[model samples]
Target: MISQEQNEFLTQVGPGTPLGLLLRRYWFPVAAASDLNNTYTKKVRLLGEDLVLYRDKSGHLGLVQERCPHRGVSMVHGIPEQDGLRCQYHGWCFNSSGQCTEQPNEPEHSTFKDRIKIAAYKVQEMGGLIFGYMGPEPAPLLPRFDGFVVDNAIRVIGQAVLPVNWLQIMENSMDPVHTEWLHGHYHEYITTQNGSKQEVAFQRKHLKIEFDRFQYGIVKRRLLHGQTEDSDDWKVGHPVVFPYMLAVGSGGLGTYAFQMRVPIDDHHTWHVWYNAYVPGPDVEIPDNLKEVCVYEVPYKDQNGAFITDYIDGQDIMCWITQGAVADRTNEKLGTTDKGIILFRQMLKEQIAKVAKGEEPINVFRDPAANQFIELPLERKKHHFSEGFASITQRFQTKYCPVAQDLIALFERVGVH
Candidate 1:
């Protein structure tokens, strides 16, 4: 666990904090491609900095300070001109490089154009998302993945605003034990037909860690031995890179999901991602599988639902409950928090490295590569209550007595 001093240091991510400096070194997702309509300008808050995302008529995307240099007016109301965004307040146009290109109100004030400029960051587009580098000049290129661009794979982009701190939500992705209990052991699976339910068993892989310039932690787990007779186990591995990016999937043909936790502020985060790969002609995709959900709620509600549902709904609920600033001193973490510990340690180390002028690790700067795999057949049958109860009983006896204890605990806590 981090001491109060470390916590304070990590949480202070504004302009000059160590954590902020390190995070700025890498590129972060700002918005999806479709979010930029004909409007050309969008107001965004990321990494505690209020900024503007705009595309000039020349078609180049730009990330610049939100307010215009003149009169301190918001640039969101600006119009897209040749290669710049012109402020609606005074018609002061700034280029993608944040240079004042035109000052229509003052043709005689050439010094105003030369003297006024807003901060601009580097931005790039990949996989239908826009990413910006908020660091110093000569920022590194965006990293690429090996399996995100495969043929026939359907790519779905979605996002949510979480009320809790970015660290809390990001760390949650690293924990594997939660799946067996939160998603499988206690919860009822909502079936399409007759509202039937099935008991799920999560199959987990041994925790493994890979170290390059940055550390990559992997947790491979899956839903196994469930109700469907033809149900193939769903394997997923979360690859957590230093800072706050998570890549999930077994590198399988039909399974792919990635999430980037971008801090909107100390107490809020924007969870964004692309999920599900389109498969080859030989692969059969399931019609019932959901690809994405976008919603809003407080942050604390995240723990009550499974990972899938949490991403869809509960995360918002949880965040909103905290009322902006989460009291970390009251948190009680246990053995199941191994992954959280590992992640924090890695983060702490990287933060220290950045403080010392050393390069941090695992920043992906290139376009991700695509991988193709055959999709499994879809199972349409639903399992009844008796079958689900039998599986639950069997799972309790064979694998985890804690499963039974948890059911009782849920009842005692009035979770029903």
Candidate 2:
């Protein structure tokens, strides 16, 4: 167990806090690229700072401090012009770089407006998401993972705001033991109905889980009962990217997924799950595959019960109910909790690196290395299989509205 002070240092994310400083050093997804336009500006909050995001008439995107420097009015109501965003209040205008460009009412001789400015960060659009770099300048290039590199891959972006600290979500990515009971045995009991068969075969299986260091981050491996060293799961276990992303699952409908979590503040996390559907060699790609599908994955039902239909829904249910920020100080951790302990230690070490004026792990500056960086995955079994379509069908044994929406989509596009 940790002391209260340690817990505070780990959880608090406001300006000047240790964890906040570390978080600001990475690029965060604050809005969907399709949501911003010259006609509307999106309001977003990240790392406890409120900001206004918009696309100018000339097609340039900008993210700046929310409140106007002149009268402290929100910038969302501002008008998007070719040169800058004109504040709805008194026409105070600021450019994409956060420089004050104009004051309609100011005198010709006075340059007062030119001297004012608001906070602005660099923004880049990628894979249907607008990412903002809040770190020190000489901003790092966001690494291009396999999902972004594949040709004509369909990107379906689903977002959720979970009431919990970001670490809980990241730590969960490292824990594989929970999957045995949580998603298998325990899940069987909770989701069983109509005399449906339920079994603990997964839980009863002898399993060994291990963690190893990878170039980008940590890899968690799992081996079941009599499984050989050459088994796919044993070799290509999921890789958890440094700070806040987990590239999980392989083969079938899983086909590797990118789960990213961003700290909205101390008590909330902004989650964006990227599921890329890669087409098989024989499959013909559709024209509409290039377009992104955006949707919200709400956590609850009409009866106030957490939705447990999908694999992720069960994971999210546990994260939020653990209490916002989680009380680590009064908790007990065991041998199975080594992964969580390792994650915490890694965080503390990286936070110190930022304090020492050094670049932390996974912060890329070279464009050559950043362009189309492919993560090595054991996809032989996946691509060789008939296709991903049949795999997604097995999970839909139980009827769910959201699954129906997704399954129907699979039928239209021919899931790969």
The sequence of per-residue lDDT tens digits that candidate 2 reaches over residues 48-144 is: 8889988888889899999998889999999999977999989988998999989889898788977898999988888888899887888888777
- lDDT string, candidate 1, 1-416, tens digits: 44667676767667888888888988888987767865788888988899999988888999999987678888888898888888999788888888998888786856878887789999898766788999876677676553344554445565667766787666666665555554453344432132655544342222332222323444423333333223222222245655776665433223355677888888788876555443444444344322222222222334654232222343344445654655566668876676677777777888898888787775534433213222222221121122322432422121232334433432443322
User: Stretches of candidate 2 above 4 Å error?
Assistant: 193-206, 251-254, 380-387, 390-416
Stretches > 4 Å off in candidate 1: 1-3, 107-109, 189-196, 203-237, 281-325, 364-416
How far off is residue 241 in model 1, in Å?
Answer: 2.4
TM-score of 1: 0.73
TM-score of 2: 0.90
How many times do residue backbones clash in model 2? 0
TM-scores, in order shown? 0.73, 0.90
